[model samples]
Target: MSSLGRHHDPIVAIATAPGRGAVGIVRASGKQLQPLVDALIGAPLKPRQAHYGPFRDATGQPIDHGLALFFPAPNSYTGEAVLELQAHGGPVVLQLLLARCLEAGAGIGLRLAEPGEFTERAFLNDKLDLAQAEAVADLIDASTEAAARSASRSLGGAFSAEVEQLAERIVNLRMLVEATLDFPEEEIDFLEKADARGKLAAIRAAVDAVTARARQGALLREGLRVVLAGQPNVGKSSLLNALAGAELAIVTPIAGTTRDRVSETIQIEGVPLHITDTAGLRDDAEAGDEVERIGMARSWESIHSADAIVFLHDLTRLADADYQAADARIAQRLATADPARLLQVFNKADTGVSAGSDGRLLISARTGAGLEALRQALLKRAGWQAAPEGVFIARSRHVQALKQTAEHLAGAAAHASQADQALDLFAEELRLAHLALQSITGRFSADDLLGEIFSRFCIGK
Candidate 1:
């Protein structure tokens, strides 16, 4: 699509992870793979058959012994003739074997693969679409089991198929609407038609449903950013260490143990949560004051920006006399008339914040207590309770496209209600919406997007 560079000759690369192990695989795919195999292994290897063979040098001496499998074109990963060398995993051995391939293939025309070029070839050859191609990278980069599972589903075309199905639904309705516009007398009073309205309602519901799922998928892909914020000595650092299950943050009884944001990526029930522990917020003029001021300013910013804010307070240290001052400071910072993004987190339950702190989590971070409840609360705020069945991996780009398509669909619905002649524009918007949907699945995308998507893939994938 973008006139991306591709080798007309066969391409070869080490497919397995680069390292010394029991076995390593060198994969080759393209037209002219047979000759490379013929020279490298010194025989006419059978297609789809794993032949135990001896690899040799140009002088026809044995280099190493391994199995070679050939997958003929129109059947392999790139719809090309493929050869795989299952050889020793020593880095030096693989390099020698690769060098032999380069030498042998030079006579038969072969080249080394660029980063992500193999997967790019697969996509170009119709083996996978853009989204599935992206899922290839996602699967490789999946940090957690849940992320891996979601990426597996994506690579299996779950996410793309859903988007395609939604587009088909919208297109079907648009066709009906366009038909009504084309021949007003042919269809039974389309606007007043009960079935038409019902169909419209169904499409709307479907769109809303998919949009919600996409949002959740987006959260799963881009984990929730939860910021810990409160006054100095509020046990924010302790809370970070507790959540991270490690000393990710420097915890000290000192008021400003954390002078800057300490971030950690954690997994809770397969949901990735990014926790940012910020410096304490308060008023003071010393260096501690400057640090607290910076921390306080950052706390307010994060509170406004983060998906959820955990407002920490040292229950044992928060004196009744200081509650008014503290709450006033926090309230003033949070005074903006916006949606609620803050959650009260009273720390230092080990110090006994009084039995009256019953409604809130009561635990000692020092003792590694109350963390389960905290994780659950975070997950609840993240809307991550849904099972992975309906969940699929989605990129921010996919979310943005879906949102744009939703906006257009809403506009189309509005037009449908107001003007008889508006069906034409509605049809146009519906087309746009459909294309936007296809963009997610890569049915509709430019070459640049494909290049960008594949560029992230590791070589040999």
Candidate 2:
């Protein structure tokens, strides 16, 4: 259906989770919900007041006894009339209540709400901007306490306000430049007199500050993907268990015990680390089984795609000639595969093995030695910095948009340097920069982009 058609129709959904709880919510939003409310409760409801009553079905039989709430238009979520039925939490009871809403509101064109359609409606109605709408989902899907707090801040408009402020500054600068562009004779001198250059520099500095905070937020939202790669029986599984603080993978002394990838997510200092322990990488043609070959292929794929690769080494075998040869081959492959994301970690340090040179860290997963250092090193490799309070949750798209804004600002600065001959160019650059910033707050977002963003949200939100 067309978006306009969907928006005009009354939408209903079970707002609470699918299982039994103390209470469940069946919510509906529309232009006017008095008819539906009257049909369900068999009485009129006061706006913003909770009316304890029995919800009835089409047959005039009680479906459930619940609390009913009526939110009038322009004051409710989605800026429309909203009706909420707080029913008993049994799955059957909620389903019955939901069915009754659909049946009762059918005459008014009520239908099941599409995923995120409610929040999408809220965005369309100016109840929340694009970033804040996305934060609703981020807050729901947050995996850590810090991530939840960041998402909450974004939902509270912290991120949108910053973007809007930057956009406003850009707009003001564009007006100044455009005014100067209108008079070619006094363009250069007028721009200098207005301190346009100083304002541009100040705006750029603010953009840089917001960009830095957005990077930290993106780190919190997406976290880091780290893969552990080494020869078989090198304590890779042991390290995984130690980092996760759980026996997530099987650790055997036999080579190739882990013939597949074992994955776990562990948080360090409120930042989640998605760690994957891959099968041991070996070049033994005689020992290659069919399953082991596939496992090794997958391991290489993980290494190439990971945010960081932990190249684990058994310190006890560092002196062995054969082991040294294998380690050299692995190092050569790593050197070719983005050395910046690779961290050399020597394990089994408790076995009386001295540390190696070349920025390698020596630790023992068995003894929990140097694990904290390894955690810190992983965070560093991911380019994650500790964010200050009130940092909002951000996505990669937000980062890219800010980057585009920064580029446009840089272009504007270049044009401003030659204001006498390039006033038009400078004004155009500032306009483009303002539009890019608007994309973050939904002032200039594409319809398809809006669809993609809101489609990820759960139904009833």
After superposition on all CA atoms, what RMSD does each candidate show versus the true structure? 3.2, 1.5
TM-score of 1: 0.88
* lDDT for each residue of candidate 2 in 1-461, tens digit (9 for 90 to 100): 24534687889999988888999999999997777887889898898999998998888889889899999988998889999999999999999888888887878889999888888889889999999999999999899999999999999999999999999999988888777777667535856788988999999999999998998888888889999999988899999999999999999888888989999998877788999999998884834588898888899999999999999999888889999898888788878788889998999989986775667788899999999999999989988777688789999999999999999999989988886678788888898899899999899998889878877878888
What residue runs in model 1 are displaced by over 4 Å at the alpha carbon?
1-3, 7-9, 107-109, 184-188, 259-261, 282-284, 288-305, 320-339, 355-363
Candidate 1 per-residue lDDT, tens place, 343-453, comes to: 777777777557483597665677767778888888888777665476777788988998888888877777778656677887887888888888887778887887777
Deviation (Å) of 24 in candidate 2: 0.9
Clash totals in order: 0, 0
lDDT scores of the candidates, listed in order: 0.78, 0.89
Off by over 4 Å in 2: 1-5, 185-188, 284-287, 356-359
lDDT value for candidate 1? 0.78
Candidate 2's TM-score: 0.97
Error of 2 at 264 (Å): 0.8
Predicted structure with the largest lDDT when compared to the true one? 2
